[model samples]
Target: MSKGRGKMKKDTNIRIGTRGSALALWQANYISKSLSKLGVKSEIIIIKTLGDKLTRGVLSQNRNRGKSFFVKEIEDALLNYEIDIAVHSLKDVPPDMPDGLILAAVAKREDPSDAYISRKGNFLDHEKRKSIIGTSSPRRIAQLKHFYPEFSFMTLRGNVETRIRKMHELKLDGIVLAYAGVKRLGRKEEITKKIPISVILPAAGQGAIAVECRKKDRKVISILKELNDRRTSIAVEVERRVLTKLEGGCQVPVGVLARWRQDTLLVSAVIASLDGKEYLKEKSVMNQNNWKKKCDDLAELLLNRGGRAILKSIRK
Candidate 1:
């Protein structure tokens, strides 16, 4: 067969499943555009998940039920063959892959720093005792307590716009959100400050878009290879592996970020008590070639340095 004919034969229309949020649509449209450049046709299908439906109050009541909260319904659609692809905010995906699903690609990441948005300028530095900051992420809450325990935190939840609106309606002093989401949604101007990674490490795969497909779908996997970013894939993989070893998730107060610098991989990880009283942090730098083993070693180091006890107490 001619190469042109072969290419035509392989050009199957892909069905992409994603959440209905603005950020999720941005990611889905991004993949769709990237595929269009490669001469592939695709459709974006919105699927709502439990994460979207549950309020913060319900979530607090069911702390143990959110690792795959955002991606579960989308994955179900993919597994049932209703969709050929599933795009997700990599941070929302659990470290453990479902039996039949595989992470086919990791798109190039956006800025991984969390953004601090306040109507009042530069709130993190100012001496504002008892200010009500808005966030529900255990990781963010723990770090904020550890660093700026003077401020009070309220559980804030919704899509980006909703959260931002709530910050006004609830009279919140400020809110911390992923800068990637804010930039993607064209709300960069709303960010009063970009939180430094040194102050609060991002969750594993925080800024990257993850593509998932059935394990046996070789054609979808091949198509997705064009979307994969190597450095990002390695960095998220290393971070996720560390989180998996630690058995950390949305319910746990753990933060991890991995980056590639030339041929080296640098990972900074932290595990803290829910109240932020006790904490364990480790920064590991290792050769990128042996990243798997190095990531395991890094997790072990954190666990040995009081991480295990912190996790045990939190679970209990």
Candidate 2:
């Protein structure tokens, strides 16, 4: 690594920009620690995002407030050269990055599955009681409604600990969260069930951490390259491509997961109505060498099978 002031000033530590949430801080610190092991020092700079500005009550009232709600500010900071690199929860990152910025690295993925947390051990046991579950994700609410129509759902948004606390304060039966966040935050024991992927296909890039930097900065790009996990990078690339082709975002009830099966890639996706009355799912397996083309093909298949109508209805 070049320490001299060519692209950057001499002896300057890499400035890592991130959101102010606990999980976001954990992600930023994780990257900083990884960089330290590589003989590169870093500093974490917390930035408040649009999503962070809204109260949980206000956010719950407006499910689709804005696109890239959690990342736009931090990305802007990176673009303005206020920070050298930005670490993001990959699921919160949009399918298309802002111009002149690139996704430089993807850390190894964690569980990438949704988890159910409740006072009791199983969500199914509450089916007879017509229990309510708390979660703000349209994808999760739609899929859960598909399986358990009798149960009601309420919108709840916050960090993992805050959500769990709200479950008690709000007197809700339980809540749904990404298992990766629970495990990463050391709250795995609170998980009632690690819902199977077959039950709930995760949002694209659910469990991964992304490192992004200015495309023109070779020094920062070179430093980030060492953190890339090829398998994780390729899988998320396929997942994000499917999302881009489908034109899905936080408001759209879309779920996609891709993983390597031996030497081939296995991908699955679903698009559903908010009421769970209409659902479309597609799966494909293709050689790793041609996953990108296969991703487009898979997306087209979904669009043809009523996905277009489903998303159109949601938009209205």
Candidate 3:
């Protein structure tokens, strides 16, 4: 086919499934626009998951038996042929997935680092240091225990907006969040400080968007070949493989964030006990091209060294 004809042919119709939330919609639209640039026509279908239905709980508080907490409902639609593909915040997706579902693409990531939002100028106000900081993740809780043990934290469960509003209502000093989410929601002004990823190793796949499709959907995969971001995939995959190997669940505290600088990958890992008194933090720099293997090896080493001890301590 001629280049023009190929462009026209690439204008395949696609249905993108996503959660009916502001941040999800933003990510979906961003993908849709990027697809349009390559002549693909797309629409978004909103699907609700169990996590979305819950109003007052954290995922870690719930039990897991291999079912995905955030992506299962949407993946069901993909398998049923109700939707061609599903887009998600990678952090929300569990490390493991259901049968017949495959993570097809990961878009270029934004800042994977967390942020602190304080209404009173500086994100973490020493004056309000004794006040509460809102969050629902045990990983965050563990880190807080290790670093900012004095600050009080409560389960701030709900959508992004709801959590932010709750922080205002409680008149808490500040709330912690993923920097990427706030930027996607167009709430840059709400940011009080950009937390360093160096210290707060982010959740796996935190800043990227995930596209999942039925493993058999070759057409959808063919079309979405245009949407894959290789660098983002490499970085997220490296971290995710570690999670998979170590049996990381939302309930435990394990965080890893790896950054690519030219030819080198700087990886940082944090393993913390449930009580956060004892912690194992480590960092290593390796050739970026071999990051995937480096990360997997690091996860293995961590488990053998002190990660196993930390996990056992936390589960008890």
Q: How do all models score by TM-score? A: 0.95, 0.94, 0.90
Estimate the TM-score for candidate 2: 0.94
Candidate 2 per-residue lDDT over residues 207-297, each given as its tens digit:
9999999898898888899999999999999999999999987767899999888878899999988878788889999777788889999
Q: Where is the poorest 10-residue window by lDDT in model 2?
A: 1-10
Q: Which digits, one per residue and each the tens of the lDDT, describe model 1 over residues 107-163?
A: 999988888998577569883887889998889988888888788889898889999
Ranking by lDDT: 2, 1, 3
Query: Which is superior by TM-score, 2 or 3?
Result: 2
Q: Determine the C-alpha RMSD for candidate 2 after optimal superposition of all C-alphas.
A: 3.1
Candidate 1 — which residues are off by over 4 angstroms? 1-12
Q: Can you rank all candidates by TM-score, best first? A: 1, 2, 3
At residue 275, candidate 2 shows an lDDT of 79
lDDT of 1 at 102: 97
lDDT of each: 0.87, 0.87, 0.77
Report the CA-based lDDT of candidate 3 relative to the real structure. 0.77
